[model samples]
Each structure stands twice: as structure tokens, then as C-alpha cells.
Target chain A: MPAPMPDISRQYQRREQLTMLALAFPALLMILLLVVLPVGWLAWQSIWHDGFTLENYRRILAEDIYWRSFALTFEISLTVTVLAVLLGYPIAYAASIVSRGWSIVILALVVLPFWTSVLVRAYAWLALLQRTGVINQLLRQLGLIDAPLALVHNTFGTVVATLHILLPFMVLPLYATMQKIPRDLLQAGASLGAGPVLTFWQIFLPLSLPGVLAGCTLVFVLSLGFYITPELLGGGRTVMVSMLVSRNVELYDQWGAASAVGVVLLLAVAAIFFVVSRFVPLDRVLGQR
Target chain B: MVRIVAQPSATQRGRPLDKGGESVDIRSASKHYDAVRALDNVSLNVAPREFVSLLGPSGSGKTTLLGILGGFIPPSSGSIHFGDRDVTLLPPHKRDIGVVFQNYALFPHMSVGENVAFPLRARQLPKADWPDKVRAALAMVGLAGYESRGISQLSGGQRQRVALARAMIFEPRLILMDEPLSALDKQLREAMQIELRELHKRIGATIIYVTHDQREALTMSDRVAILKDGKLVQIDKPQRLHDHPADSFVASFIGEASLLPVRRADACSVVLGPAILRSTRPVPDGDELMLAVHSEKLLIDDGAGDAARNRLTGKVTDVVYQGESLRVFLQLADGTSLSLRQPSHYEAARRIPPLGGELTVTLHPEDTIVVPKARP
Candidate 1:
């Protein structure tokens, strides 16, 4: 209405906005079509036998076998996460205290296994934690055990393997976060009449919480979908939800049941994310260096 | 209602106030990182109820000494005494000290009242005394009615005042300030400097202030310790450190000055370049002595000054017109140059001083400060 010809500033701005939208639309649609479409289709398949039925969910909820695997998966993940926290915090703190050169050395050692393939790492764990592996062999030579302990193809093996693989995921983020909280803040805490324990409790512990939350979230979420580590080390005895879903789809050739279980796992992850993000902005916590 | 709280009983009672009224002794304190010594053999005595500033350039160990006093770092050598009692091996929490950091390390998670109440809580003070002390400390710093506000809501000056309040809540024996006003703007820093001086006088508590800013140190401190390369170079009053610097570093660090290298020839005499000069006192021979003369102290005259004392003839190289004064740069025939700055009210600089023109200037013996040679 105002102009017959183009106003360069207005036209350029409009063109820029249109171009940005045009460029981003394909990627956006790809995410929606690939991820969102599959998730929605799984949600639909979860409740419907042919048209609409809650039998699959009812069977999952009512059965102890399904419930046992769900509980054991959560239990293994949570315990491994807590154990990793206990083991990782001290190493991170030590790295923060030592000289930069030594800190880098220890840091590299802690995170070095992350560069290796997780399946290879899990297999490496199987090689170490198996019945006649070096650990049991050492125990025998040390006269601690008369026989090799069963360390593989079970819940213990799964947890041990996952902790080994995810130990870096916890330590690196915590080390990065600990490096940021200025050393003076702790010193200031001590100078103001807080003992080292109290300083750790009040300042260090609380400040490192964001990293703890992030590491826990990643470890817990990924452990929910653990197909390789638990599949390899869990040794057919521990049929977790991922292995369960894979068996249903590949072995039984039941697409509907697999999709149903997948939907349940997805919802469980979303639910945990919903619960944790209430205390912390999950994006900010995870996105921070 | 006078209670006789004796020092021994008070000391036994584990109260910091009893140990409050004596100078702190830091003897042969040294901190080393592998081979590099951050502070070396630094033995300093902070007098009771006196404000002393550790003035130095960055990385000169002023903050390290303060950190040791504040119990943040352990010295590789020597002991520290609070009053007459030695407390060298004590951890930070055992030492009842208050610290105000340069960044004004206020607890962002807490309110103003909560921040100020932290020290009292640290001392395990009676619950009843906290509110009264908090009110008094906040009122003392003129931050009344701002108790409920967040740290983000306060201005830089207000944040500093809150920090001061928090540091003094328990009435600690000594307050260790590590450049507390450094993070503020110039106007706010200057204002806080005056406020800090008033607070020191009002409280009469022993304070060890650390700063790289010379003007702030010179203005507020009763005595200033100049540190260079982890060693205490000089410790003197403001006027003394300014008027009679102990060495060339002190002269240059304290304020702006033009140092002309001079050689001692005989008693009451020295030669600056080719010009042999007479002095009021005997400058000792065989040591390299630098004669530090302030810019304003040099008098320039166009007329022939054959009658001048310690007079020298030099050609003017540059004349800088400051709004209030003029800084006259001169190069002697021996290739030594000096800058003489005088107030604009003293107009002799304008009439006859031209670049490359020969001018005569006089350096007074009494006005001149004799600085010792550099330490190896």
C-alpha cells in the first residue's frame, strides 16, 4: 500500500527473515519427520493391538519379569552413577589442586578410555572381569580366593562395565566445573571460619551440583538405552529393556511389541528429565563448559 | 555494668577480642612454588589498631603475604604471631580473621542480612546477638534499610559497603583487605577510600590493606610497605615514603618523578654527568646513588643563573602545556635529560623557554630526596 517499488532496508530485512526460515525449514522438518514421527508412531503402537487396546501395557505392568528388568536397569544405573560420583569427585578435586601439567596428565588418564569404542571397552571389561581374567588370577595368586569369582554376564558385570565407560563422562564435566569455581572462594570460606569439611559441604558441594546433575542425567538416560555394554556384559542373564526390545523386534519379529517397549523407555527418560529439570535448567546445566 | 574481661580469661574463653590489641608479627615468612619464591623472608610487623597497606606492582607478593595472614596459604618458612601469641601453624578457620576480597565476594545466594550475619554465625555467636550486630554493622556502613535486597540489586559502592559490614560483623581482631575497592569505579573507589578511613578511625581495629593503587594507599594508610620482587623494600609513613623514598624503586613507584643518575665525588658533593654538584650532606662514595627530583621541584629561569646553587645548564627539548602547569623537558650538554613541571601560575616557563634554547635550572638540596642504591 505504501510503495510500488522496493524499499531496500525493508525488502532486505524481509528477504533475510524469509531466507533464514527457508534454510532452516528442511532441517526442522527432518527432525520432526525422522525423530518426532517415529516417536509418535511408537506411542500409537504402544496402546493399540489392532485399533486401540491397553493389553501390551497391561502385560508389561502386570508381569514381574518386565518389572524386574525395569527395576534392575534403574537400580544398576543409579548405583553406578553414585559410585562414579564418589570415585570421580576426589580425582577431579585433586586435578584442580595440582599443577597444570600434572592436572592435564591425570585428566587425560581419566578421560583416555572415552576415545575408544564403547563396545570395545565393554569387551575389554569382559576380558578383565570374566571368570578366569587377570582380576581373579591375581586374587588366586594373592590367596584371597580359592576359585575365580563370577564377574561377567550378570548385573555386577553390567554395572562394572558401564561405570568404566561412563567414568570419563562424569569426571571430565566435574573437573571442568571444579576448575571454574575460583580457588579463592574455598579459601575465603576457610578464612571466614568454615573448616575444610564445612567448606566442602557448603561451597564446593553445592557449586558442583550442576555438573553432578548433568553427569547423572546423561549416565541415567544413556544407561536406559544401553544396548552394547549390558548386552555384551549382561550375558543373556540380564535382559534389560533395550535387549528386550531388540529381542522382540529381531528374534520374535514383533514390531508392535518392540515399538511399545520403546515408547515406554522413551517416556521413562522423558519423565526422569522432567523431574530433574525442575531443580535445574537442564539445558543450561548440560550446555555449560 | 563493667565486666572485668581479663585477657587471660578472655583468651581462655576463646574470644578474639582479648587478642585484639597488639601488632601482628610476620617473621621470615616465605612461600615457594617449586623453585619460584612468591614471598621471601618477609618479616613485617603490623602495629595494633593501625592501618597498614601493602603497596606493590602485580605479582610482587603483597597479596601472598595477605593470603598467608588471611590463612589462605601456608608459608614455606617462618611463623606468624597474632598480638604476642604465635599462631603460625593454625588453619584458617582456627584463626579468627575477617577478609574482604577485591571482588567483594558477597554470597550471591544470600540476602544482605544473611551475608552480614555470616561471620557472627561462624563464631557461633548467640542467636540473640546476631540481629543487633547485623543492624549495627549495616548502620555503621550506612547501608540501613537494605537488608532484604539481593546482591544483584546493589550498586558497586553498596556491594563494597555490604562486604565491609560482613567482614567486621564479629569485630575481628584484624581485617585483611585484599584490594577491596579495586573492582569499583574511580569515583566510587575514591569515595570508599574516604569512607574506609573514617571507619578505621571509628572502629580503631588493626587492618592490613593490600593494593596496587599507590594513590589509594598513600591517601588512606598510616604506613605503607612497598614490596618488590617478593621483598619488603621500604615501610614508612605516607609523607616519608613520598618525600624521602628509601630507593629509586620507591621514588618511582610512589609517585611521578624524574631520576637523574649522579656520582659521589667527595663529602657534600656529587657530579651529575659533567656538572659537579655540592650537597648539604655527605652522600657515601663507591655506591651507585640516584638523585630523585620531583618535576615540580625544579625551577627554570631564562636569565643567567651563575648565582644558583646546584645549578645546571641544559637545552630545552620539549615543553608540554598542562592545564594547571607546564612540564619542561631539558637535555644537558652531557646528554642527560630531565623534566621540570611547575604550576601555570608560575609563568616563567612561557616567556623564554624554546626548544633547543639553553636554559638554566636549579635543584635545591633540601628539596632533593637522597635515595639509596639498588639492592643486588
Candidate 2:
């Protein structure tokens, strides 16, 4: 007896499914081993310290130090995101419009810091931003100020360093988006009786919103878990969630407390991702479409 | 959500529906980029409500002239005057002229209504008057009730209509179009040429249209300006441009005509290989002359031995069966080859000579066009 057409088609579909699974198996296995297993262990440790009690979470909520760290983390991330947008947008715009050779040079300068160690760059900022540093000395030589300003070892230094480190993240996506905007649209806007300023406001700005959104989301999320720059520049004064998690583990050897803090920070980042994804698709935020 | 606004008469508002166009006087304008002369010493005048087309091949500086007039490109020298105002250095927004781009350039981010309302917003018109104005503009383009549609959802023709509606929504006196129909298909482009003529008549705006298609220029414009190598070659009415071309280049470019080298025989005649052809127009002053043979003007000789018509003998090389007409290719005794078109009816088909057979043709004195060879 010959097999039916539907049966043969079903067999072909089964083979296609098996092929797709085989192609995806390596990456899936790596994720299962590296990310899922560690996160599961952390969650289990956070709750099952003493017969699965919720004591670690309770202590985290009742503690004032943990609350301050969480609040400070959000405050700094917001400030950095806003500053990155203001400072990075013009650089990206300039790069987009310049000649191709100059545009590559500007982009190369932005990416130059990535070749150096993050710790080295953070320490370099410390040297330049300290009291009576290069900026203060120049100001004094110019007779601008009588006394040196407090430029380092505080939230100011932390923000300055963090913005410098994260600016490339904001600029690259903005340049990508701005370069794709057709020059004809700008000319059309002008010929339709719009001045340069009005044309930029109505046409250019709206078309670049995708880049702005993508850059802000990336910088903000990365700022949440930032450790080295804040640690070196914050001078142990500006505490963040990551700092708290490390302190609980290294100083006190409280594995359950550290795991609980880790789990909470992870949930916070996930919640933010969820909210932003509701507004813009994930692929678009990653500058895919 | 789509909002179907209430319709109102154009006169109900204070806007002038009967406004005539503005006269444009471009005087000796020239544009240079680096060392290349994009436009050189080209001066053109356009009367109010007159439709003039700038026709040329690619890189012929037709677009550069339009750009200078539209204020997108600054002229390296000379000035432009609109009516009594000299607007040589004015910016595009302050000049108050509309422009329709080739690709339409409609805002992909805005709805169809918003795209049309953009000019009004830029001019700072009243907020309450937008809905009625947008509706009227859309209706003019035969796209009524499409205000809520997204630009991505519309077809190419619909997008073109939307672009037209947006450009003319504010009713500028001078409108500039840069090859706007080049993106459309052949059938759609022909249909639009007529529609555009009717629209120009109703609006009464002085439209400076740029195109590279010679047929389109002859079909639509009251006066067609031909450009060559950044120079104004010829500017005349379409019929005159077709009937009496300025030179051999203009003769061959404006329509289907073959040029054959000839010598001057008299004050009003020229001599081909063995025949003397008379022209009603004056012979141009040049060292060399060529005769332009319009394919449609040539008739199959009936062997009646007409005296007024110039006759020539040739051998039929090939015949092509076009849908409505038959093309007969022939080779003259002096090695000059030319083709003529005849109707594809049964009688005409039977009259056509066989391939490689001798055939006699005649051209009337009025149809004989002899022009000077253009100086390179």
C-alpha cells in the first residue's frame, strides 16, 4: 500500500522541526548551563536558607541601608541617561553630516576608549577630577576662581565618569539612525515653506526618536549594574544596589543576603525591560528595524 | 481614527480662490561647482499663468536652473525677480513657492491628513481651519476621505496624488516640479500629463516643470525650453519647436527625424545626393547644412509625377509591423538610411513594396526642414 500525501507531508514537517532543533541545540544548552542554572541556584539560596523561610527578603525591606542603595541606583541611572542624551546627540549628529572620512575619524575617537581597561579609564578620571587637578589649575591660572571646587570623591565624580564610559553606547545608535534619514525629506520640508529650525523640529527630530529610545534604554540598564566606576569615583559615599550585594557577600559572608539582593536587582531590571518593551518592540530598541 | 470633516466652500473662508500666478524673471543666472559649470548664463522669463517646461537630457543643467529658481541652489551670478520683487538671495521658505519632488517625499510618520496640513502649520494658519482645508485639498486630487490612511498603505499613484495635494494645499503662486511623473509607469504618466494640464488651468499658477522626456515637454507645455550643456539652446512654443527646429540637434531631438548631410543649392533650397529640396523657411547661416526628414511627413509616391513635391528613389531594406502603423526602412543611393511610418491597414500593407525592391517617396516643400549643423 502506498503512503497518503498528507502522511508524507507530515513526515517532512517532522524532519524540518528536527533540523531546526539540531541547529539551535548548542546555544540553548549553553544558556541552560550558564544563565538558567545560576539564576535558579541564586533564587533557591535566597529563599531556602533556613527551611525555605522568607527572612532574607523581609530583612532587605526593613533595612534602611538597602532602601537608600536602591533609591540611589535609580536616581543616578536617570541622571546619567538624561545627560548622555544631551551630550551625545550633537556629537552623533555632527558625525552623521560630516564627510565620510571625517565621520569615520570621529567614530574611531569614540571607540578609542574601549581598547583601554575600564579600571584604567576610571582611575584616569580620578586623577583629572581631583581637587587642584588640571581643570582647577587652569581655572586658577585664568583667575576665574579663588578656591578649588569639590570635583571628585562624590556623586559628581561618579556621574562624570559613568557618562564618559557610556556615551559611545548612546552615540553609535543615534548616528546609525540619523544616517538613514533621507536628505530629500529635509529639502522637501524647506521647499514646502518651512525654515531650517522648523524643519528640524518637525521632521528631523521625530524621525530620530527610535535612536533616542534605544540609546536611553541601553545606557539606563547598563548604569543600574555599574560597579567599578561608581566604586572608584563614588569614594564609598554613593552606594548602589551592586555595591550592597558585594558588601553583603564579601564583608559579612552572608550568602543568603547577597543572593536575595541579587535576585531583587535582577527583578528590577527585568521589570524595566518589560515596561519599555510594551512601548517599543525589543528588536527596534536594539536598532534592528 | 478617521474624522470626516464637514465640507465648506472655498470662498466661505477669506482665502482667495481666484488669485493669479506671479511673473518670474530670471536674469543671466549661472551656477558653478568647483570647476564645472552646472548652469551658465541662462536667462528665462515666465509670464503669469504660463506653464513652461525645462526639457533636456541628463546632466544638461535643466535641474540646476529649476534649483536656482526654487532657491535650493544659489546662483554664482545674476539675479531673479518675481513680479516687482528681486528675490535673488531669498531663502526657500521666505520665497513662498511650492515644490513637488520626484519621489514625492511625503512624511512617512504622519497620516495623510497631517501631511497635507504641514504647510498650514508652518505658515502658522488658524488651528480651526485645518480640517476643512485638508478635506478640500484631498478632494482636488480625487483622493477624498483618505485623510486617516497611512502613507505605507497607499499605492505609488495614491502617494503621488497625496504629494500633489500637499504641495498645492496653500495655493502658492509659483509651483516647481522636479521630474514628478518620472517614477510612474508609462500609462499612468500619460494620463497624469493631461490631468496636470487641467489642474494648471484651474489653479492659474506659473509652473516651472523640469523633465527629460521630449514627448512629455511637447504634450503639456505652452512654451518648452530646451537646455544643452548648461546653455539655453532653444525656447519656443511646442508646435514651433516641432515644426521649425533651430538646428540639426534640435530637429533630431524634438521629434522622430533623420538628418542627412546636404549642401546649399540656393537661397531657399538644399541639394541632397541627386535631388534638390526646397524649404519654406529661411536657410540658416552656417558653413554646413543638413536636411531633417520627418518620418510621418514622407508619403509613398503615387507615380502621378507631382511637380511641387520633392521626389527621391530608395531601396526598401525592411518592414516592421507596429500595432497601429507599419515602419518601412529604406537605404538611399548615397548610403543614407531612413525609415517612414504608414498606417497598418490592409490597403497600406498591400501597397508596401517587398524587401530589397526599389521604391519612390515624395516630401512636400512645406514638410522639407533644412537646418544648420550646430557648432560644437
Clashes of each: 0, 0
Residue B373 error for model 1, in Å?
A: 3.8
Residues B138-204, candidate 1: write the lDDT tens digits.
8888887788999999998898899898888777778899999888889888988998986776656
lDDT of 2 by residue, B85-127 (tens): 9999999888888889899999888999999999999999999
lDDT by residue for model 2 over A1-289, one digit each (tens)? Answer: 9775676788899999999999999999999999999999999999996597899999999999999999999999999999999999999999988999999999999989999989999999988988868888888889998998788888999999999999999999999999999887888898888999999999999998889988998899899999999999999999988898889888999889999999999999899889878978877657476
Candidate 1 regions exceeding 4 Å error are A1-68, A124-153, B1-20, B273-276, B302-313, B321-325, B344-359
- Provide the TM-score of chain B versus the true chain B for each model in turn: 0.89, 0.94
Identify the CAPRI category of the predicted complex in candidate 1.
medium
Residue pair clashes in candidate 2? none
TM-score of 2: 0.89
TM-score of 1: 0.85
Candidate 2 chain B: worst-modelled 10 consecutive residues by lDDT:
B3-12
Best by DockQ: 2
